[model samples]
Target: MSFRRVIIGLLCLAGLAVVLDFGAAAYSEYRVSRLLRDGSDLGADPEVTFHGFPFVAQALDGQFRDIDIRARAVRPDIPGEILVEAGLIGVHAPLGDLVDGNVRKVPVDEVHALMRIEPVELGRLFKIPDLQVFGPPADKSDGSGGSGGTGVTTSGPIILTGTVSLTSDTNPVPGTSDSGKPVSVLADLRLDADGQIQIVATDIYYGDEATPAAMVPEVNRELVLAKFTRTIDTRDLPFGVRPMKVEASGGQIVVEGVGKNVTIDLDRLQQP
Candidate 1:
């Protein structure tokens, strides 16, 4: 064969290889979406992206360097829905399973995820209408330095405001004559040692009028405690990541965490 012909043939082969590699990557994405949706009860199809070129080579090695999946409106039998984004590292998948068209399990070395829960959904979970929660700069108390220089120091505190129902028999609100009267209050958001969310009413208000906690009655305080305290379960998050931190920003709650050495099955994820 002529040398020029040989060169042309090699170029064609390289082009074909590139096309095949792209197809393989596309197939991998589809398979991952199906696996997560069918096995994990994900609310919607997750967007999966495979990192690195030549996915076929990664498949042969039975490991992927990086994979990302983003899911929206994920409702995992939890009280509220959240948007979840996960980055998986060192994912292992068997070539044999891929050939058989049955991807049973995938194990990952590490998984990092971020979950965003909107304020509206949180309000619904709390049974409060039109709830607004945010972290505002705390009041800066006047201070004096050792040299007698006056200054101010700032603190951070999370505040939550909502109309709380007073008619509930279990925990009735005090100072309300009518059953359906809604009371507005500014509550403090705190996390307990066990990672549970606790809402404590620091001040109560009635149409811009401040109500003293003493005059609110003891039963009303108990009502506030009972109505606002909630425990968030973090054991079984998406991709098995445990929630480590929670923050309020832009009227939403952002929870972020990481998982180590987790195994997932496509079939099990589909179960309720």
Candidate 2:
């Protein structure tokens, strides 16, 4: 081929690459913007801005307001999952009793999370990841909302809630061991007024022989105890100390409030 022809061909290829790059950038921007708009439509007043090719969102509460979530990386056994980092994100309370004044505020900290949603047996999906909360936080003093008034007011203590379908592995860690030894969960969880969350659940799975039939006394008790300990753990700093017991009935488990200053790890309890 002539040298001039070869040079022209290379220039054409370079131009095509540029066009493709621009197209991808534009699409990413659109995706980010769409996500923000959705949050706004859901009553979120968040700030959205593009940082290079990445979209950044800051919500009034540390929730998932103007954030970006990448959908392609969600797959089973595929380690690379989408990372969703949000701020000032709060939970929507359809029930009023949970909040003191019916007012829910988002936490101030940034919630950084690595998550994956997998549809496995029965087309069920599970969310896995470690979420961390950082920054100065508004007080979760009571469930009375922000204003500390009685009834279902807008301002009150904040509680974060999410659904875990039975299909996926929800418990990252087994709450206890067979020999009645205390197993510490390497997880942290907290809820703020803005409706943001930061928590971790690790090492959760059942053994080949592990089944509901075999999960008598030991397994059952551990599961109950785990919930009880978690409720008191978060308020430890403010309340001095709290101890509790957990009971399960029907499909729901209940944690009974213990007296005071005594904290017991349910994994350490023996079946009576």
Estimate the overall C-alpha local distance difference test score of candidate 1. 0.61
Which portions of model 1 show Cα errors greater than 4 Å? 1-20, 72-80, 95-103, 138-156, 168-196, 199-227, 267-272
C-alpha positional error of residue 221 in candidate 2 after TM-score superposition, expressed in Å: 72
- The segments of candidate 2 whose C-alpha lies over 4 angstroms from its true place after superposition are 42-272
Q: Per-residue lDDT for 143 in model 1?
A: 45
Each candidate's lDDT (Cα)? 0.61, 0.27
Model 1, C-alpha of 166: deviation from truth (Å): 2.6
1-272: candidate 1 lDDT, tens digit per residue: 69999999999999999999988888878877766776667777878898987888998898889988777645544455677778889988875575355766678898877776677677787787656554543334544221111121111244455556566556545534333344445555544556444555565543222222223555576665455555554444465555676666666666667878988554443224
Q: Model 2: per-residue lDDT, tens digit, 196-251?
A: 22233332222221111112234344443233223212112101212132221111
Per-candidate TM equals: 0.66, 0.19
Clashes of 1: 5
